[model samples]
Target: MLDANLKSQLKAYLERVTQPIEIVASLDDGAKSQELLGLLRDIQGLSSLITLRDDGTDARKPSFSLNRPGADISLRFAGIPLGHEFTSLVLALLQVGGHPSKESPDTLAQIAALQGNFVFETYFSLSCQNCPDVVQALNLMAVLNPNVKHVAIDGALFQEEVDARQVMAVPSVYLNGEPFGQGRMGVEEILAKVDASASTRQAEKLNAQAPFDVLVIGGGPAGAAAAIYAARKGIRTGVAAERFGGQVLDTLAIENFISVKETEGPKLASALEEHVKQYDVDIMNLQRAEQLIPGRDGALHEVRFAGGASLKAKALIIATGARWREMNVPGEQKYRNHGVAYCPHCDGPLFKGKRVAVIGGGNSGVEAAIDLAGIVSHVTLLEFDSKLRADAVLQRKLGSLPNVTVITEALTTEVTGDGRKVNGLSYKDRQSGDTRHIELEGIFVQIGLLPNSDWLKGAIELSPRGEVMVDARGETDLPGIFAAGDVTTTPYKQIIIAMGEGAKASLAAFDHLIRTSAPE
Candidate 1:
């Protein structure tokens, strides 16, 4: 039981006391649990001793009514409040308790008028140690604004919830029940999103605002690359993206990308994002473009976001990349992290000395099988086609590996798993029409990728495969519009190729701007 002083402090901190706060202990030891509970109670008691005054100062006033009336704030700690994470939690609590202004005076005034509650849910895995920083930043925002409610859900512990949310990566955050952002972020960037969301709401309450310039769609390699170039070229640039890295974040190691010999997808995305920050680019992560229209000038374009805000750009660059097609068979999504994986590099190391299966006969599949054979106990390569579609050299190399077993003309039908994790997969022989199941600990899906240009529709001319068409200089059919990287109908989708396209597009856009500005 909590002491009177501690209970009073907890009550004061809570804006609404509709129900008693439940404390769930994650500690395994019984003795340790009791010790931790006592420690928490002590901390609560200490918190009550401090009082927040309106004069931007804290007073030692002993009162249970310290909370301002009508305050509807809530704090959510996603992980165990330990180590550096504890400091973040404390800061968040202080910001919430004091109701400090986190935005500009105008922005704060606008946010204060917001009636609807804004909820932010951040999903994180325990393996990702970098997630705590994001959790702390969100907590602080919730603390500063009474209208904001923040919750952090553990990705692994709450597998069902994670699946429902489609949480593929760690440190993923959602705003108002929709996917909002991902990866680790600083307090300022987090607060900026909150402000942006609030501002959008405020504008909706009113009507019509000026459109933005240089709306660079997508947050992956091409989009980020375009924003960096546009901003550096003295244009007001804004990047609207569903996620920061597109499919690139899903990759584990990128060896083919030039300059960097070997790097992880997440690390590469982070570096590219950092480069964009060096310029005046406004990166709006977790924001999706729902519609596009031609601007008044006919040469420019306008993009409307899902959040009810619109941006206008003198030039538009479609950089939305592709997503790997998933095997929608049963138990596939359920056991995604447990055994079923798409990227061999991201989760391959975890299955060392275990039986693993690789689906598809493409270059990616053969490469994954060859890589896994070096680490795992056994590697089974399954190909739906009669012959491997990979390069001759790769096909020969994969066949030469003694540990790799090739199953030609095999198509996966089902992924069977114990309630907790995957145990094996069921497949069918395409030629013989025989179905079979193989026992394995891990499965890697390496099917071909689908371009992300479906959203463009006929607004931009695309290839038969739905890839944006670009010229040698990365110029699209439309004047003042250009594209680059994998999203375009470029022959190569490698990292180096994408980076080269990005550079070429930047030069093209710069040249266009210069030519148009010169006196005739």
Candidate 2:
């Protein structure tokens, strides 16, 4: 049931859609179809701009379509829209109504100039927040072009398709019945992968003869900050990264970003890239760094990529970030993006009115519990320690919530799920030597973080935990090289902290350059 506050919010969001959007429901005879139809009726009644129509003729499953008044669109959803995907559905309708696509002019022109026909089948789970972005991007491409066709499938509802295609994860994209890509990707990236002309030739390799004055590795917050600071000093700055936003793109909410009260991961990541473009940093994205070689005779240091392309720089700043730690237990890997997820900020909304569990008793777990308590029906937190490791203030807030339960000294045994999604979790309590299973729809694992420093294996001095060792000024054992962010021994992993460390590393590199020579 929609509350007054939510109804008001939906009303505001729908007011922006001035144009009328026609929805056609293609459903088979079943209880699931009835449920989906009921929800659609409720949504249609929310605003006069939404009009619902019945299409029982060519229906194979409980599917629906969104289009303009006269023409059908490429966007279709095969199953009930619930969890985080509800936002995707609303956005699709709004975009078809009046809201223009957010792609840049260059991106729109590229989509318009596409000559060949392409059909995209994207698989998704309702609880996955990352799946919506890819779906929305593909839908936008379809809206911008007439040759492209797109469909969003609920993986669980269509198990035969999942089994046949081996769809193991959400956002699993297929182009013309062949695997194109998986996971989160930008609109331009998806277009490039499907567009023939864009993928016909190899990218231009790097030139080793020319060297940059300073090269910043990784395109996360830390690397971006370093590149910006160094470029401000009029140095020839360059940055190489596998992706522009790094791990930030995987994050969901940003309540602790300072000054700004709240933000989403992708939004902040986009802004970060936009800000870095204002500088003179030579951005080389989608390139993974493999090896690092020290400079000879005070020449440029060499950084090698996977494809043998290499860059030469006088000084280097390593800001390679970290990824979320996994449970590594049974069902954890099998049910990723199905019922077990690593990011609460992105996937929390999908669990609204559903019971969920948070593993770990640290600040993150407690914070997750507190945040989820407002939306979900209940939150059960499991801690492997005798006492909670979170701050007293956090503990106080956690205790105040009515829908939260805390279990201490418990070891998570396994994540239990059906073949398609998670349903429960098994845990063993240390005190009583008892095993218990909790029936919940989702499990959030926030135990810790693992640095992405395995590639630097023997090249740099690393701690036992694989964190790079650096001094106060972010200088590593290798004199001309510096490390920052979670990859370094910078204590904590946070956006603001990483940004500050990046700035510090850039200044330290600038000081090193002055001691040697100007941007010679």
Candidate 3:
């Protein structure tokens, strides 16, 4: 189950366990059960304080629980926790064994104060990059609060429950036996939903902060760079984002980053956040920007959030970034996370042996088709153009796949589904002007991205496609205001490009601040 190097690492990690822990396994005479037993024995060998038992009685065939003898911590795994979930397993063990967490003190307090009987069941896939955050957060809650108990189940292992619940996506969470959410969610977002007053309290805290010299509106690569640059200038800097990692959190592979040979999106995002924390920048996550109030006659610019809180800054850098472009066809929104998904790498495992469709024939779409062909039974690639727009290498790789079929000049018309989940989709043949429908269990939309500049529409200068228009210095038409990254009119929207743009915008903002005086 674990290799030599992996065993060495696990042994080192288990040394942090301050308390005794028990691993109770519930197994059967199946091959997977035996495999799980082998894994458990390997884990038990790593730590002397850890004991294994086999008198377990879980309904799931191959499952286990990590529990502290006298504590309220109750964490369970329904399948082998490997791949992206491997870190989750390690963190759960450390947390359940009384090791300290890296979460902020405020967040810890929030979890400790939570009241009520909350039972959480999260269905996840091993290949999902977004699942670890959800799983780790919930497991922490279970370890912290006695009222909270979480069971992270592998959706691929338990196909019966997935079909019964019609769970067509990864990180599908259920609270109290009802569907709670179906996407990448962090601790703050989860607390906002479970605790009624969490948002109001957060809004109040944000509203009371002092004004900053530079304020960034996003927390992606651009926002992190801008914040660091501004803070390094010995000025007060602040960053408020809906989520710290932004769209990069949803990305799977990132080989285009110059220095790094190969890396994952979440890993890069974490590094960015950690780098920014070394400075004096005030980092605020899970804050969505709503309205923008430009300063008049050297006044401070104020950015309002959806939570009814606003922050003022001498200069503003808008790096809100972009999100996955959605298919606005009928039934698409209704069946989202039911049968329609955006991140193939995150949700692909849930559709094993199932027929799915990939909309678009670009690099992202074609790449998605190739990746899904291995997990899913068949993949239908549809392109609105006459030919695939992917690179020759990618197109060649996509062509060689036996389980994938490509269609040209096909327009996705509407998503078809029953009341619960998607069943098929309708498309139009551009040449014949005839509509066609294909039955599939899932749909992965990989068209492109849309700029997150909708809120700056009437407040700032924007291009026809909603991208913020900026000059070489990353400054907008309005003085004391700058924009960067994918939200701006940059030629190419790459992560490296975004960071460079963010640094430029921050420096430009600092220059503007030095030249102007704030109104009294």
Candidate 4:
């Protein structure tokens, strides 16, 4: 299944493998398992130092072992390492095969300093490109610290564990059976999380009487930019969110941002956090805003969460972003992070030289098809509308691609996949009244955006589509409140645009604070 060029690349990459690495695949012979076995066999055959062993001597189920040379450190993959998960497999092989870690020496020292028998159980999926980074980071940490143990579980293979933990996101990391974080985390952020998990004071209530000059909600690029701007002005700033990075964490490649030739979502997110931390901003990570309560005395507003934690501020900037709209077709969720993926930039490379289909004919869908066409073997663009809604320029660009086949007025009914991954899509022609099936290895859905403003339903005035309305300065309908990013009435939801809006809102909030005198 490997292309000649890709095969050659893998062969050259594996030449640096100094010691033999053993791969133990104890699969139950499922459809996905067979596919993964073939991939492993191909990889093993390419490298002289690589060995594929099925001793069945290990007592674990659906287990894979990568043993380090001259060390008892053995990293395990308890799932099929396909899709984006392939990166983690390669990282594990190289790490155990005696390759030097890319992490800094100081960072390695800090990791080694963490003395605990903490079991890091990371739930991941193959299609998630971010999960591999987290898994490999933990694997590197384990290699550095003898006390730390890391386990990578394929959430799809272990549905029961995922269900028990109520894991809704990929790359969900649990430190000693408690939620550490989700998504691709930066090294410093993960270290801080590890320290926080070990700290006992996290349960203690923070000072509620402390009022902030400005409070920023949401942690994506917008909120981070907002907090950074507020802090630069020497104001008491606080930014709260479920996790830093917002929807950006779920994205793969981000090349559109000017000056940044190329960057990943997780990397940008971590950098945002790092930049915000450079200032004296009071950041509340893992905080989900529940209710927007009007502030009393000194503070103008207070936001409550499910855990009874509340924060008060003189002004607020709402940056809670939007999420990808799912097609909600059969096998869509079941095969997510398997063969069905939502991120074209993140998971596109995984489907390189493979046939794929894109659902939706809007700008996002067409753009995604265009992006995937350059990486994949062929792209079949299916649109439910009679005519494509994408811009004429985008349509022209998509048309110029010979490998792309555009099908309009196609009503997608189901995503057909074996128990493991998506193999084809079933759709019906709107005018012809004929059903059609297209064989594909991956599917990308780029329907539309659904703003994450449902939580502010009764608290503030929102547009009909649940987008928070804002004026020129990112000021919302309510005074002392502003919004930015995908959650607001911004014509387009772009990172650079959101960051600019966030800075504008923060400056406006500063103006409000200076004029009000109430915070004084």
List lDDT for all candidates, in order: 0.67, 0.82, 0.94, 0.80
Best first by lDDT, ranked: 3, 2, 4, 1
Best by TM-score: 3
Cα TM-score of candidate 2: 0.75
Model 3 gets an lDDT of 0.94
How do the residues 1-520 of candidate 4 rate in per-residue lDDT, one tens digit apiece?
5778867877887877887777777766567667667777888888888888765454445677776556666467776776677777777778777777877686777888886677888887665767877888888877677777887988767766665675545777898878887667655557756664422333244334388888898999899999999999998999888778998887667989899999878779879989998999887766677888765454578787644577778898999999888888888988886677777765565566789999889888888999889878999999988899999999999999999999999999999987767889999999999999999988998888899887798889999999998999998877788898889998888999999999999999999888775553
Better of 1 and 3 by lDDT: 3
For each candidate, how many residue pairs have backbone atoms clashing (under 3 Å)? 3, 0, 0, 2
Q: Candidate 4 at residue 117, lDDT? A: 73
Deviation in Å, model 1, residue 238 alpha carbon: 2.5
Model 1: CA > 4 A from native: 1-213, 295-299, 328-356, 361-380, 386-406, 414-425, 439-443, 514-520
- The C-alpha stretches of model 2 lying farther than 4 A from their native spots are 1-73, 76-117, 121-132, 152-182, 191-210, 348-355, 371-378, 400-403, 416-428, 432-441, 517-520
Q: Candidate 4 has which clashing residue pairs, if any?
A: 252-346, 295-301
Deviation in Å, model 3, residue 334 alpha carbon:
1.5
Q: How many residue-pair clashes does candidate 2 contain?
A: 0
lDDT of 4 at 196: 49
Backbone clashes in model 3, listed as residue pairs:
none
Which pairs of residues collide in candidate 1?
96-143, 212-312, 214-313
